[model samples]
Target chain A: MDSANERTAEEVAWIHRIGQGDKAALQLLYQRYASRIFRFVIRMIKDEAKAEELVNDVMMEIWKSAASFEGRSSPSTWILGIARFRTLNAVRGKKLDTVELSQAPEAVDEGEDASTGKSQEQLRALMRQSIARLSDEHREVVELTFFHDCSYKEIAEILQCPENTVKTRMYHAKAKLKPWLKNMGLAEAELGGVT
Target chain B: MTEQRMDELLAWYANGTLDEAERQEVEAWLENNPDAQLQLAEYEFMQQSVAELGDDEPVFNTEAGLDNLMTRIETEEAANEAVGQQSTSTMLERLQNWLDETLNWNRTPAFARVAMVSQFGLVLALGVVLLLPSETNEGYEVLSGTTPAVIAAGPTATIGFNVDTRLVELQQLLREQQVVIVGGPSAIGTYQIELPKDDLVEARLAALKAHPAVIYLQRNEP
Candidate 1:
């Protein structure tokens, strides 16, 4: 099987254990993806405290729901599913449709992740601006597929669409985004049609 | 593959959705068409740009969140525990109160509550825990003559209710439903005559005649 699928199996086992109230299982799962989960949620929620709370809620759900987990799908997929559910719930309460990812939930690496800081605020703004241009469906799919590294099959499962349709949507999504990215400083050299 | 096929295939290629044969075809197309390689890279980056809108991973401190959450969780859990605790307390209070009431004497002290519930200790405590009921609507159902506790119906029944209501919502509650009107009063609502000969339903139908109304119900109780 694919490596991600294998990893998912491992996670499923850990979750199964966590459901048994094993904090170690939870800790292991936490160590595996807390940063990424936090990152994903922070993008969705745009609040440090709320994002963190959702991250906790997501993991807690994993622990709470582990025993009943039938391994019908990947564990990461399941966890991210929870994250998505929690994020949507949080944002619904916020009365917002789409969340901007530029707002990092909490302090980023002060040095390495400077885009999360002040100097790159304009870049972040441009990024968010470019992204905000897409429809909510497109944005949601892009978030799940690329940023979350979810497979098209996984996305189809998550979004309740045929796999081919996901590809088509992603195709249209990328096509729509190209001109925007190109306008934001990526010249012909970047496109390489001329260069 | 033809250029048009190549274009269609490119959609599947970017997401790696193409099967083995199609992927091979894409590989050949890329090797011969350097232009397609450039297109793929650009597509990938653009995909990232779109992904960035959702890539905002504000640092989520699970520890910190759980810390705060646990406080409230603990509070609610405590309130629940206290609530759960109060039932036995109430039971004991009631028991003591019943004793006081029967004897027509006085109310028992708070400590009497703890003492009386100790006999059913573990069972009541566990019952209090596992059965800490979710908050039910406090609205008085005048039909029931008391505040009706929301009982969780069958899991299947809940699913059916949700689906039916959703259908009703989508179609103004009358789409797939075939209502057979038996007879109802001029007021109220038209009653759906379900049972061919249900006396209770017929009586309900008769009683509803005082007002302009519509009564719709299924009387089949099997």
Candidate 2:
């Protein structure tokens, strides 16, 4: 089997053992997923403490509901779905969406001139700022696609949206990032002829 | 595929998650449209950049998280076990009392008393065996009124109020039904309420269910 399928198989097995009240299995699952879940949640909510709390909550939920998992989706997908649900709830409860982008710290240093010779790190920082500026829906599509390594279908599953919507969001996200890429000295032709 | 469609698939292509057919289609398109190669290269760079975004962020302390979760699981299990033990103890006591009242072993002859005692021993042993905690019985208790105390007290129901339901309005409604909130606002925002008396449980439940604020309600099954 491919690596993804093998990972899924291993996760499923751990979940089964967890269902049997095996703490070791739960620990193994936690070790595998806690960081990933935290990263996704921290990106979503932008709160480190809440993200850590949610990671624990998600793991605890998996422990409680392991037996109920029928394997309809890959374990990673299911776990991410749980994380997304919890993070959304927390976001709604706190009205975190009201937080303005202007309040967000800039990713790029103002002292560094983009036109002058820039280091790779500076370019990456600018890229991060461009990405961080995208709307939540668009940024999520980008994050799930590139960072999480999820396919369109898996992204759809995590976001509970249509696959076409995922694709469209990614398209919009890239379109929004194009100007920033151009400003960062990338050639226009290199940006896929995107308007 | 159209250029827009191919553009949409480029991210997945760079991520190497496209199916073989889709991969081939993208490859063929790229072969014909050589300019698309730069776009594909840009996508690969975007992926690398996004992946590295977390590199500067604080690392999640997995061991600490696991420790916290384990502690929570242990506490929850302990609470559930206590409830189960209490239930079992109450059941055993009730069984013993019923046997005493029915058999009246103290008033019987010596031989008859001995036989009755032996039978009571067997019955108690069976009760203990049956009531031992099982896999299905252990863990979080979803229903609040399933406990022995709640079961003996009165009827209860789980209700989910509308998010927009006003506090005063909810109070008036619960006051009319003579029920008090017992547990929850669970993960799904459902609450467990205990009714005043079991006499008009069905009518009280119907009234509660009919309330405009009562979006969801389930009668607690003991």
Candidate 3:
């Protein structure tokens, strides 16, 4: 959390520069938040190709109107909110069949093993697939909590849900995964006690 | 202890949403209950499992991320641009309405438009780019031709010189309407010249605007 605070402060400097009409600062801001925005959008839309295109639009828009930002919220929060709004609109208009999770390639490789021939990639890929199977709301809670490393409060704020609601969604997500884990031939002991 | 109660507390515990007192109460109960112990493990399992998922960057795929950004920018940009156009049109309509209701816009179009736009105070300037003399094939042609000396010359009057330096001087003495020529050089390193009497008055002013340092127009006889 301290580190995230520091990152936010640095990003605010970039935001300030953007407010002053600095094009370079605007690009830096785009690059800084592009992945975060992409993840949120992709997770919602579940369509990699479309998500990538939307991310570029988000960046171009940032460049075009950096001056419009009034610092009503921290730049990160504001960008994330914009991403959220965009994803919501996109998902609303999109057909359910458009977000086919099986079609998109893995987002990250994570690679096969750190020391030996053991492949973390396979494990990570499995994890991603499992998470993708959750309901949109469930997956979103997991995404906010695990991937973004957001605290429950932050997730609540981002999702505009009550704190308890976020907890409930997270509880549900974990419960949905139990059967899958049991099939993996791993219990608490095998998966490093799952902690 | 009931599994339902344990499940409830475990959810709060996993979220770290429990207060200190409730947390202590859970901790005290978990110290003895085996079922509570398993539930505690379940809660811990959920938290760690999600944490270990380590999406550090969920939208790490460059191609997808850029695509997402582009789509968003389009919507926002279109919306903002619409708002901008609407506001500008609104202001224009309001001003026109006010003018029609309050003031004498029955004035001439030229005067009314000028006053209206002038309030915006946006000045636009344009400057012509000049080429260096060495870069021009026409440098020699202008070197040889003659020009009138000044505006009073009725746009055509004799102004001539023979050498580069003499031409330079002559240019200094002519107006935009004035024309000058070079008949060639004399033995004394000066130019043979002619200057029409009619343009004598405005020759100097025209020469300044014509870049006198690089051209010359002969002065009219004083």
Query: Number of the top candidate by TM-score?
Result: 2
Residue B169's lDDT within candidate 2 is: 98
Q: How good is the docking of model 3, by CAPRI class? A: incorrect
What is the overall TM-score of model 3 with all chains considered together? 0.47
Q: Is candidate 1 or candidate 2 better by TM-score?
A: 2
- Candidates in descending DockQ order: 2, 1, 3
Candidate 1 lDDT, A17-120, residue by residue in tens: 87777777777888777767777665554467666666777876776688998878677667777787778887878775455434323322222423333433
Off by over 4 Å in 2: A96-99, A107-115, A188-195, B32-34, B54-56, B90-222
Docking quality of model 2: it rates as acceptable
For model 2, the interface Cα RMSD in angstroms equals: 3.7
Query: What is the CA-based DockQ of model 1?
Result: 0.16
- Taking all chains together, the TM-score of candidate 2 against the true structure is 0.66
Per-residue lDDT of A78-166 in model 3, one digit per residue for the tens? 67666776677676776534345565344333333221343545444555666777777888877766556565666666778897787
What DockQ score does model 2 reach against the true complex? 0.31
For model 3, fnat equals 0.19
lDDT values of the candidates? Answer: 0.57, 0.81, 0.57
Q: What would the C-alpha RMSD of candidate 3 be, to one decimal place?
A: 23.7
lDDT string for model 1 (B1-222, tens) is 566456545644665646688888877887746667666765565455534533433445556555564465457668989888888778877876777777443565667756655756977888898878656432112222333423222110000113233433424332223223322221332222332233353454333332123223333222
In model 1, chain B matches the true chain B with a TM-score of 0.34
User: For candidate 3, lDDT tens digit of each residue in B1-222?
Assistant: 455555555656656656677677777776656655655565454455545534543436654454555566567779999999999899989988887677656564877768766754543211222322233221122223442222232222223333354644545554443444433342323343333446454653355335534333443333
